[model samples]
Target: MGRWVLVAVAPAELVLIALLAAGVEVPAGVRATLGLLMIAVLLVEAGRWSRGYRRGRRRGLGRRAAATVAAAELVPPPVTTALRWEARVWTGLVRGLGRRPDIPPGAAAFTHHRAMRAVRWTFVGVLVVEVAAVHLLVPAGALRVTLLLVGLYSLVWVVGYVLGAGPVRPHLVTADRVVLRCGLTTRIEVPLAALADARPVRRSRDRTASRQLAGRTLHLVDNGGTSLDLDLRSAVTVPLPRGRSAEVDALRVWVDDAQAMARQVRAAAGIGPGAPAELPPGR
Candidate 1:
């Protein structure tokens, strides 16, 4: 009930706010009614969320875990995902600035190759120029200000991507799992026990989807290509954007040193050099 109310009211509130931001004059009574409706809806939702949190606690969940579960249950999945992604972007910006990769203890970090460097920098440069043009050419108004703000926000995301996909967030081979990441957007963690085989394979550059699913294979491409592939014993759930997931029996990713990554994963999974490889069916 609360979720439905929020879904219905949130968009109306946003539209109203946007109109006000764009200097549209709204009638006082209509604005007051919408404001009161939003407040009432929020209060009801807060009560429900509180109850959910308490229920989780009563079931012995930790505070953070309970809070997370409550939020997951109460909030719409798309909103939750967007909030999570935004948090990751800002966090990545900070970590990238510090030049720190999120490698856990006893994990081996393998950086992705700088295959997208030229493309990333070119895109950022274009965004900077666009922002400058907006500031200089557009008349001083709310719409111009909105465009400028959006442009600057986009620039921040590009910087975050450049740093996050570089040294700050590398492919990780840990004792128990293989953590594959594409900047702040996608992550896939496969347990070492589930790893069937690892190998270096070249993918064509014409295939431009950063994350693609074909049959039972999930491709995590970089610069339009992938350099390493991992075959799993069975299909595992791979999370996607907008609260979606895919069950994939294989994963293809790009890394700086494909050979090293394959070797490390093989070694960690206790697969001998002569072990039979059970490759997934062709894509």
Candidate 2:
């Protein structure tokens, strides 16, 4: 029922918004009716979501997992996940200003930002130039305003992406687990006991996806390449966007210092010879 309402009303709402943005006047009665209908839909969906959320919690799911399940009950999981990703990007911009990595005590941080810094900044520069050009060349009117707004929003997204790939997210190796991250959206955690091997390898590809899964292997690429490969003792669950997950037996990741990272992981996990006696503190 909620899905039907959303499917029916969402397009109309979008059309209304676009009309308003384009300076096309809409009747007050029509606008008010649409508004009330939208509000009713939201209220109904909210109630449904609350009930679903409680049921999920009662089933022993974590807070985030429960919320995601509840949201999926109201709308498609991908839509909810996309909305959350956008929110993360916006918040990441503010968090990036602090220039602090999400490192914890007794964990070692391995950063991959350097590999993509130049590319990210270059893209951002291009966006700025494009925005400026559009603003100057476009005439004053609804179209111009819409284009300008879109350009500005694109600029913000790029900036957020840059930040998300940098200090806001970094790979961490704790005493018992290895936490691999790409930007603010993707995270994969593998227990030390599950690590079979760690090696330094360079694998470059012509793809723009930050995260990719092929068969039982997951790739977390930066700057179009990966530098380290991890082999797990058994398949472990890796979470993907839109409430999807994969049973991964191996992982390929990009980091600024792949050799060092490999060494640290092997040492901590007692995988190779001359393993360290104790885990090092966060860097």
Whole-model lDDT values for every prediction: 0.84, 0.84
Q: Write the per-residue lDDT of candidate 1 for residues 1-283, one digit (tens) a residue.
A: 6787888898899989988978889999989989999999999888888999999999999999999898789887777777777887777788989877788889999988477777778988999999999999999988788889889999998787677667678999998999998757677889998898998898865667677887778888786789998988867899775568989988988987899999999999988788646655653
Cα displacement (Å) at residue 210, model 2: 3.4
- Model 2: per-residue lDDT, tens digit, 95-179? 7877765688999999889866887789899999999999899988888888998899989987886887687788999999999
Over 4 Å off in model 2, which ranges? 7-24, 46-72, 206-208, 240-243, 274-283
| Best-performing candidate as measured by TM-score | 1
What lDDT does candidate 2 reach at residue 237? 96
Candidate 1 error regions (>4 Å): 7-25, 62-64, 183-185, 232-237, 240-249, 270-283
Error of 2 at 132 (Å): 1.0
In the predicted model 1, the residue pairs found to clash are 113-256
Q: Lowest-lDDT window of 10 residues in candidate 1?
A: 274-283
> Which whole-number lDDT from 0 to 100 does residue 13 have in model 1?
92
